[model samples]
Target: MALATLGVVVPGIAAFYEFVVKGRKRLGYRVQMDTTATNVVETDDPGVFDQLREPLVDPTLVLLRIENNGQTHIDEDDYAVLHDKKAGVTITFPDRKVVGMVVTELSDDGMRSSFEDGGGLAVKGSRILLPKVPMNRGAHYKVLAALDTMNGKMDQYPPPKVACTIKGGVTGGKIQETRSRTGTPKRVIALIVFLVAIVVAQLVVFTQSNNGAPLDCASGHLNVTGSTAFAPIAREAAKSYQDLCPDATFGFDMRGSGEGLQFLDQAGRDGKADGQLTFSDGEKPDDMPGLLPRPIAFFLFTLVVNKDSGVADLTGDQIERIYQGKITNWRAVGGNDLAIRLISRNPGSGTRNAFQRRVLGGVREPGTNSDDCRNRDPGSPPGVVRCARDSTDAVLRTVESTPGAMGYSELGAATGRAGLTAIRIDGHPATVDEADHGAYPFWETEFGYTAGEPAANSLAASFLRYLTNQVGADIIRSYGDRPCAELANPQLCRPT
Candidate 1:
């Protein structure tokens, strides 16, 4: 009986060893790697992963293909967030000394990263990317990875290591790259006569406001768009730039800063320029490939409520809870007995993004980004957060009309507007004077972005260059935000 039992147990153990251990080995032995063909860029296209912190990094896509060439089937799983949740895989770049790779999957559209959603999974043989790594152009890299599974063991992110190299990219030729004569000799003769008459009628209206400055430009047009927070400054700066180069025209209208970055992305990525949007202003975006951000000024976002509400102040903790939907009543926060009506901006709005990030500390505000706004409502009976308005004036009016309504907006937008009262956060009054001097805690730098450095002769490039000058500084201050002329804080400092 003992011999019979020993024979059965011994065979089972050997079979298990052959199936598991040998299978992983064979899988690793037969792995392969494949990379897509691409080119290096001449112009510097900068991008940032952590908008509020990280330095600019160029966007370089790296895709790796892993296959099973072994005689055995090696079961595997590749999921960045899920893998981490279930005891993730071990990956490394010996050349860069980066270990523990967190692989992410594509979005439903398969056009974006699921890093935010934290959902990427793979089984058996598949292809994966080097989850948004900043790599130097015109260079080679060695990547290695490993993983664990239910049925069998795993090795490396794709099994065997691969060394890949990158080269420079090329662009198409510009349209009408040279000059051409448009008029005939007879037309030119008439043009010369017309020019003489124009010079005789030309009168210089020199006012003290001009300060002896004259319209001194040739001819060109540029559109400045996005970031209503910075619109005043940008619009005013257009006048200043025109003072130096009057032949050039600039367009800046009312639009959210977040939408401005999208304009830049569309222009940079698809090479399609908007008829009236040449530059975009706002907080820098996370992915900034083929672009650069210049921090020009600083501004604050203030919390405001209907003047009729009895609430005057709130602690940071209480304010956070209010947005979290934990404290649903105005009375709960020392206000009149009323249901707190939460008013919020769209996710695409730059002001909303700043308020959420700075005030909520990355926590989702209740009733925002959900079937409504977030996940839950912050009212007494639990209701969807209401849209205040896209325009600052409109938002202020909405809050004033709706009793118990509270919302956030740029300090400049709420100030001087009737029927709205700005609330103090943590005993600190939200004001431009306080925020500019760093007395207030809630403020963010205004950013302008472009596709690398603009061409030397391009008016858009010239305008950006002028934006850093003293004239630009003066114009930025005229807006609600303070232009950081001499500041040590990186957020306020000008980006090189």
Candidate 2:
């Protein structure tokens, strides 16, 4: 009788353990932004919902999707071991500076909020594990790991950095794999193993801090330069393309478009133009000849003022007068009764050229940046627009700091800066929709030009091809430049 009872008990225990405790529970992860998806929040404010495509207003969060590819289920309590890491996302910039989310916005759908409220879609706490949620085999769960747009550190046409690690499993004595922790000794060992796992992950991260640092490739170095306007975009593209072709590396110089065209011309003269690539935020000059024009992205210049200016929209004609030193007071354009400070860029700025031609009726404005900004007559208060910054960064800072100050920038360069407001032109704001509908007029077409045409197998050609495709276009859009596809509306344009 005793022997029979032992046999029955042992078999029963083994069967129970096989089905309940040691079932396989492996997980795989993907970090993706659902570009096709948009989460719109409605409020009493009129027309806010209608203009969801205002570039910065879209609140699509980046999702860290966890898929249970195991044979067993994973309860929420078992999976809640997800915290203890930084915001669950890691963003490395072109300069290899790593920035983690300091604002712990770990939240989810139930904790929904808008971009205005910093209501991004991060999952809030391990609280979502309260009811012991189950992750069945082949099932998926998504948590908001990061917001689409983060302020401060990320400003002006930033690149996409999608490097992250998502680790999930049971904690404590519950061995997630097919290992048994049924005894006091085993449980103690399991706990030790857990601590070691945590240490190893941290060690791997710190041990190789310089593992993927951007390379200064001199061997197969691909030098690209031009347009400070497009320099930010080029920097990002260089990083991404390096990831694609590890053998091909890049150097980007943010000299103005004039320099870009000049460099290409020199390269052409030396018969080494095959080794160069250049980009610009404006059209190719007639003298900068022999360059194939491959439009990479669409960029726009927007009139902007300090947020305190109380001025919001400006017609083309009014903007023309302001830049031409005609209109000199805020009250002249329905704002405070302060002097209308005319801000201009240094001489030969491509932005200035475009503005002068399109809005200022091609007439170059008088006064050097210093000369115009000079103290005016006490009686007149303000007059000709003066004050110029050689760089866009300086321009943005100048505009934001000055009261009643107005200036212009490539839409991307101006978007994320604080204390600055991009005024609408003719009641239409710069947006993808406005660009598509042709309502927001006169956007500069960005071009990537090689000395001649790049060969099919050439590195420059490959990079240019990448830029003109759907994926490349998406990356460009991520940088705040309108992809050529929007203009290609019924037609998708690819590099020849």
Q: Top model by lDDT, which number?
A: 2
lDDT of 1 by residue, 165-284 (tens): 111112211101112223224553344323422321232123223444443232488767677666766777788777776678876665776677777777878865533343333456
Off by over 4 Å in 2: 1-219, 369-382, 488-496
Q: How does each model score on TM-score?
A: 0.50, 0.54
**Residue-by-residue lDDT tens digits, candidate 2, 338-436:** 677667766656776766765676788776435335345445534554677776777788888887788877888898888988988889998766755
Model 2 misses residue 98 by how many Å?
30
Cα lDDT of all candidates, in order? 0.51, 0.58
Candidate 1 lDDT score at position 260: 71
Name the regions of candidate 1 deviating beyond 4 angstroms.
Answer: 1-219, 273-282, 368-381, 431-439, 488-491, 494-496
